[model samples]
Target: MTEMSSAPTVLVGAGNMGGAMLAGWLDSDTDAGSYIIVDPSPSPTVQLLIDKHGLRHEKAAPSDVEAAIVVLAVKPQMMETALPALTGMIGDDTLCISIAAGTTVSTIQSFLGDIAVVRAMPNTPAMVGRGITGAWANAAVSPAQRDAADRMLSVTGPVEWVDEEPLIDAITAVSGSGPAYVFYLAECMAEAGRRAGLDEDIAMRLARATVSGAGELMRRSDDPAETLRKNVTSPGGTTAAALDVLMGGDAMQDLLTRAVAAAKKRAGELAG
Candidate 1:
């Protein structure tokens, strides 16, 4: 259990990712009373947590609040309106962490002045508390504030801090968008199974289960994924036969390399 912080933590959104973090914090040792959720329309899940924990929920941002951390979880599109309204929440000691994609630290600093800022990119898996966040903090952030932000984000998953802010786009290209690529693999595998005479339902189930099980194994084992693949492949086995086509001429590697490159390029464009 995390030691509870007496100072309030202002959460500016209550959507999927935001709601997941909120739920995680409430379930942990963090004081339930320390949260202040600011959302015009809170999701049922978020509202339920608020009611059950006796947390504060306001339709509009409060001007008189002095919070320890101000989490900017609203969508990038809504940030223009949200930042201006929530500027008062950024006191001298407050640490501002923005989870909104494509919003740079400079933009946030412009709106809220030179307060400590941590910009983070958290993926969809955060909804299940299995996400990994790539965070980058500006020079103004203190060590204590960095630790505080890390503890807060750990409720969702591990935190990977990078010194170069631009590397976040690469992280965005990889883990942030990586889940969809895995899902697409499952979809492709299911279709291939159907073409191979398996029932559509059975094929889909097999594909989904295989992908998830392999992911779990990778998580539990210290072995690298390449090593795991080698362990499964015999001198002349069916798995090797399949890998021959997949790995032949590095087809899979080349495709994914190009795909991630494109994603990173687009991320830079969006951020600009």
Candidate 2:
């Protein structure tokens, strides 16, 4: 494995997503001594990890240390307030990776100045080590730095790299916000089942299990989702009847397309 760097990695937040990433790093056997956590008020879970690993912790970015890698996991609205203190930790070779949604690379550089920056979007499922990340690196990033970023980001799951920055917004619409969509699907499914005469608790259980099980099946299957759908759907059968409603005149497709577009548009607005 390539050494990430000799200098310590400065993590600027320890909220849910930040804590998840930190836990993944330690679980992957990353040197606990190599991290400097800079959260003012870490959650109990994060505090436990820090104490367990004996990692260095600080209420704010320390001026004495120059970071090789910096992970910004603060909220978008908090970036302005949080970033200024972190400027002292960045050096010429520092690779900054920001996972906060709607915060652009240029915006980060504005505070930290021109250095390597990789703007990434990772979903909530990362807390469970099953998330996917969409990442874009600026021109300043070196190959080694990019590889290091990939390794750190991939601890949760797959990392999808995009050539253009704008595509990150589209990814935000899809996978970044996709988990909530899945959850809402389960909600709708449960309600439908309840209306169809199943007991409320039983309907919810069925919906939850069905959604999660299907997701697992897709994860393990080599065949595409369409093929899997077709495999279970017999001609003139119950599955086909459901598909007729969902697929008829592209109803689902159009609805999802419009929904994704709206999300992407809002992401752009937030970035600005």
Candidate 3:
């Protein structure tokens, strides 16, 4: 368990993901005073937390206090624009946790020299606290510091440590960009339901709930997803009938492989 109250967390850019983390921290054992959020146009989530908890909200960098943990939550493209102000708050020992996709450790080190940094790639589903994050730490981070990063990341959902920093791109491709794929699956399923003449709202509700419920089941159960899938899919059943067309030519697999490759390419471009 992480001692959330022991050290203050400063988050830069309370956008979708950063705000989700702030919400999660608010619900955690962490003290309200331990949290700080920085963003230009704060979203509804940020506003709600500020009004309810009186959590620290600043339009720019907070200078009065030095944070034990600083989260760089701005987008990779925006980091260059927003990072200089953050340097003032980064004490020699302050641990930096960056959720900026495609912003490498080297890139951040250039902005904030020698401050320990842990790079993380987390998906959008973290908004609901069902997200998983894959993180990488540069050699400068202490073992204890890395552990701290893992626990903090785990607050959103599951956390995995990557041995190679470049693997963050793979993580981006597989998981960071993975949520959209799941969402699209739900959309497609709903559309298919509508085509089958079900009412539009009912079709959408069924698709969303079924997909979400299956994901929850996978999360809570001991059995593998394949096992659960097979359990529901009877021989020559409706699902199996659909599977025959979808999986027969390995169509879904091939399409997803291409999609992941495209995501990986874009990740590289962003890193570059």
Candidate 4:
């Protein structure tokens, strides 16, 4: 295994998500000199990373260098213009990882040649180091390369791998966009609290703390979420009353199913 300090990891974009991963790596004690940050306009946060790490910064990918891993974090729409510049940098042994949504392994391979490619979907919470990633690799990736990809992505959060590339679209629907769904839930909950006569500020604070605390509990607990809900609910109580509305005819479940389906369909559309 290559030492984290000596490994050549080229980051293609140091935007929010990418910068978060870089910060996580730095915090985890990976050497500052390990990264080559390629961004046309570095954000203030990324500029700090450049200064702290003594990282190599370039407006475009350098032609002569070989990287152990090249991470592509640009927007899907910008991929066409961005990818061609790095084609020369991708050698057969290099593991190329893409965090852009709706971009496929085949499309990435087409741009960079037949190199190992891993397509990853990571949500926004990664900015705070709470993100989760779903990844799928093409046939060219060896077991070692897959492990390396997992290690690199794990810097942001837990990494889950799907056997089939298409499954990444489902992963996209679930976890990639899941944070927004949770945020919207908090918004609605706060509005409901306001309707229940709480002050707007208090409502928002309660909603935020409730959602985040429950999420942390879910993360730390071994019991199923259903059990956790049942434990909180009393017979014919306020919690039960709310559950009746939410669970009535499986309203929440059906609604979420439709939402996820729509998201998956849109993801597939974007892939094409």
Candidate 5:
């Protein structure tokens, strides 16, 4: 188990992502006493965690204690109203990690007054401990603070750091919003299968299983995804016939490129 600082870690939200992080920290054997959950209305799962762990629960940010780290898990839309209330929890040495998408570091600093900050984008898969994070730290963050951010963010899955903050929008497009794209693919595949004469339920089941199984295979294998795709596509085989449509004239690539660009554009608009 990684040792946390003596000062408490203040969590500002207890919604899905926030609750998932709390679960991960507890499962990793972090000291329950070191956390202070500050949510007005925690979900049933979060409330159960609080009761079971005997953690300090507050309806709002407590003014009495300075936190070692404060995790901002509130929604981007709620950030303006929420951040001002938590300013007292920050100290000179405190590190603030914001997982609120499209809410820029400058926007956070506008309220918190230039403290060490790490802006992160984590996906829904975090609930299952399979998420990947893209993080960018401002100049104020020290090496130690960055390490702490990494440790905390890595609880769900791998954490990838970027030098430039604008890349976060790209990361958000590619991975943060990527899960929905995969789900859409599954939907499309299921519909196609149904049109091809399979029962709707069976088609959905097959699509779900294939997507999940393929994802698991990609996770466990050392080979690149391209290598795996080629390995499965025999000349003149069924898989090859399918790939001809997906890869032909880069049809799939062009479609995804346009999709990601649209997402990135929206992320920038949100940042503003």
Candidate 6:
């Protein structure tokens, strides 16, 4: 196995999600020089890292370099064109991991041909290292190769392993698309506060803080979320009044079920 710092880990895009992953790796003290970013329009966040570490950022895939790992961070729409252009980088030893939402492991293997490949679905919360990634590797991957792949992804967050390939798509529907659902809740909370006559700015501030604080509490507390939730809800009080509207007639539960189902269907469609 190659030493973690020996060979370059090529990152294929450096936009918001890509940038976040890069920052997390660096923040975790991974060798900065170990990254080679292949991005045409790298955001300022990526540029900041380049400036600090004097890291390599190539407009196209380097023909002479051998990457220990090649991370496909580009958009799914662009993968068909981009991966073909990068055919030279794939080799027997390179372990490729893709963070693109809809692209499947087989689709990646179509371009990579025979190298080890892992399909990963990570949520936006990875920006803060509070995310969980669900990943599945093709059968060609060895045990040591999978360990290396897991270590590489650990730069972002925890890894959850799966047996079959299709589960990654379900993971994409859940954790991959999960953050936006939380953000929408915050939005609605702020809007409801405004409707109840609070100032718009204050309402927004409260909603953001509450949502973030609640997540932190859940992380630290031994109590399950349901327990904490019940602790706030009184039998004949304001919290109960709010829960009556949200939980009554299975409103929140049904809405979330439909929402997740739609996301899952869309993930499959994209993979197709």
lDDT of each: 0.89, 0.93, 0.87, 0.89, 0.93, 0.85
Model 2 backbone overlap count = 0
lDDT tens digits by residue: candidate 3, 1-272: 23532557788988889888888777874468878788878889788988799888899987787778899888788989988888778877788999998898888888889888999998888988889999988888888888878877888899999899889999999999998899999999999999999999999999999999998899889998789989999998898998888898899999999999999999988999
lDDT at 213, model 2: 99
List, residue by residue over 1-272, the lDDT tens digit for candidate 6: 23543678889989877888888767765577888899887999899988888889999999978888888999899999889877887766888889898898788878878778888887887777778899999898888778977876777789998998888878887888888999999999999999999999999999999999998989899998899999989899999999999999999999998898899999999999
| Per-candidate total of colliding backbone pairs | 0, 0, 0, 0, 0, 0
Residue-level lDDT for 90 in candidate 3? 80
Please write out the lDDT profile of model 2 over residues 1-272, one tens digit for every residue. Answer: 12767898888999999999899999886578889999899988999999999999999889899999999999899999998988888899999999988999999999999999999999999999999999999999999999999998998889999999999999999999999899999999999999999999999999999999999999999999999999999999999999999999999999999999999999999999
User: Candidate 6: which pairs clash?
Assistant: none
Which residues of candidate 2, in runs, are more than 4 Å off? none
For candidate 4, list the clashing residue pairs, or say none: none
lDDT of 5 by residue, 1-272 (tens): 23446888989999999999999888886589989999999989999999999999999999998999999999899999999998898899888999998999999999999899999999999999999999999999999889988988999999999999999999999999999999999999999999999999999999999999999999999999999999999999999999999999999999999999999999999999
Worst 10 residues of 2 by lDDT: 1-10
**Model 4 reaches what TM-score against the true structure?**
0.96
Question: Model 6: residues >4 Å from true position, as ranges?
Answer: 1-5
Q: How much is 50 displaced in model 3, in angstroms?
A: 2.6
Clashing pairs in 5: none
Report per-prediction Cα RMSD to one decimal.
Answer: 1.5, 1.0, 2.1, 1.5, 1.1, 1.8
> What lDDT, from 0 to 1, does candidate 3 have?
0.87
TM-score of each: 0.96, 0.98, 0.91, 0.96, 0.98, 0.93
